[model samples]
Target: MKTAKILKVATFFSWFACIGLTIKSGAILVTYLLSISNPEASKNMYESLNLFEYYNHSFLNYSIIVFYKIVLFSVEAYIAYLVIQLLKKLNIKQPFNIDVHSLMRKISFAIFYLWIIAIVHNTHIQIIGKKHNFELSLFSSDFVFLSLVIFIFAQIVKRGIEIQSENDLTI
Candidate 1:
């Protein structure tokens, strides 16, 4: 009973995260478009990032960085959506199911993809800032460690599913 309740709460939070991230990504994209028309808009880009200098530096670099950010956020939102689906399909009484296993794998892959993008994005920022003498910085996340943990958990779940199937066949 407690586990089910916890799962319900987790599902709610995951849905909330998915919606919030989607909104954030859309707002960033809209800000980028607005900045194109009004350069002043770049001064207070999404969450007050203030990429005006980058905008002035090189339009291509500005667009690429913003696009990478959008992709990162979108991937995060997708991961949250996948969690919600997994939670919804989960059965407390019979927890080992193919859908759950597959969803776990999908989530792990999405997280891994996000990690890769983040690395590239950060590297791009560092190289650009260094080469151009700009002191720009983007917050780095420990996504590689996180993705590995989730991937390991997914593998454990896969093993559980296999064991459960074998047990059921014997009965």
Candidate 2:
């Protein structure tokens, strides 16, 4: 009961954060596009985000950064949505249903995809850092382990669901 309450609260907060991030990203993107079209607004809007601090002159770099941001935020939002769905499943009477197992696998897959995207993004940043003479924090060991753990948990849930179904059918 307590855990369900906690999960409900967390889901709400995470949803709020995800929505805020989406709005923020959209605003920044709009500002960036406006900066490109209008000379007067360009100076403030372009410098507002400082996204192109490393390579201000290269349009390709700017586009890549914007694209990366969009992908990252979209992935994050999807993860949050998955969490909400997972929580909803957990709070239900039949939490061990096939839908719950499916949600677990979906979350795991989402995290895996996010990991792959992050690697590409980090590599791009590192390459830019190398050329521009800047340092990057790079990947965190904690994140790697967390993602693997989540994936393992998802597999466990899937296996549990299979066993549960089997038990239900047996006399």
Candidate 3:
């Protein structure tokens, strides 16, 4: 029972983390779009607010980054939904039937790997003109690491679900 509770808590945290990522990505997208649509206004606002002084790049790169983050966030959110469904199935005492949890686990792993690649690509672009050694922005690195951690936790929860299912079948 305690194990089940722990799994539930972990699942909740994973979902929360995914949602937080989505929100962060959405904010980035909005900022990028606003900057693109009104460069002067955006620049003035940035100057006044004293934010993003380091992002001295063209709108094209901003657009591309925003698009990438949106796609990644969407994928992560979908995976979270799948995890939630798997949890629901486990809660309702379903007939030990499908390998949905395993499938979701693999999908989550794949998405996390892709996210890491995207972060690397973005970081490469951000450091193009800078004289830094493989410069990675703090935000990008943090999100990548957070996604990896969430996926790892998802895999652990998946394994627990599989084991519990097997135990149920034996009884």
Task: Flag clash pairs in model 2.
Answer: none
Error of 3 at 88 (Å): 2.2
Candidate 1, 5-121: lDDT as tens digits: 999999999999999999989998999999998988888877777888889999999999999989999999999999999999999888878898889889988988998998899
> How many clashes does each candidate structure show, in the order listed?
0, 0, 0
Which candidate order results from sorting by TM-score in descending order? Answer: 1, 2, 3
The whole-model C-alpha lDDT of candidate 3 against the native structure comes to 0.57
Which numbered prediction scores highest in TM-score against the true structure?
1
TM-score of each: 0.95, 0.80, 0.55
Tens-digit per-residue lDDT, 1-171, candidate 3: 786887699789768967876675666566666766555433333214212333445445544544655666666666666666666556434423355555555556756666675676566456652543323333244445655676676667667768877897999
Which regions of candidate 1 fall more than 4 Å away from where they truly are? none
Residue by residue across 1-171, what tens digits does model 2's lDDT show? 877788879889878977876776676567668756553443343235454454365667756766776676677788788877877777355556767777777877777777787787788878887787654524322345666787787777778778878888994
Q: How many backbone clashes does candidate 2 have?
A: 0
RMSD of candidates 1 onward, in order: 1.2, 3.2, 5.9
Worst 10 residues of 2 by lDDT: 38-47
Least accurate 10 contiguous residues by lDDT in model 3 = 45-54
**Which candidate, 2 or 3, would have the higher TM-score against the true structure?**
2
Candidate 3 deviant stretches above 4 angstroms: 40-56, 91-96, 105-109, 112-116, 126-135, 138-171
Name the 10 consecutive residues with the lowest summed lDDT in model 1: 135-144
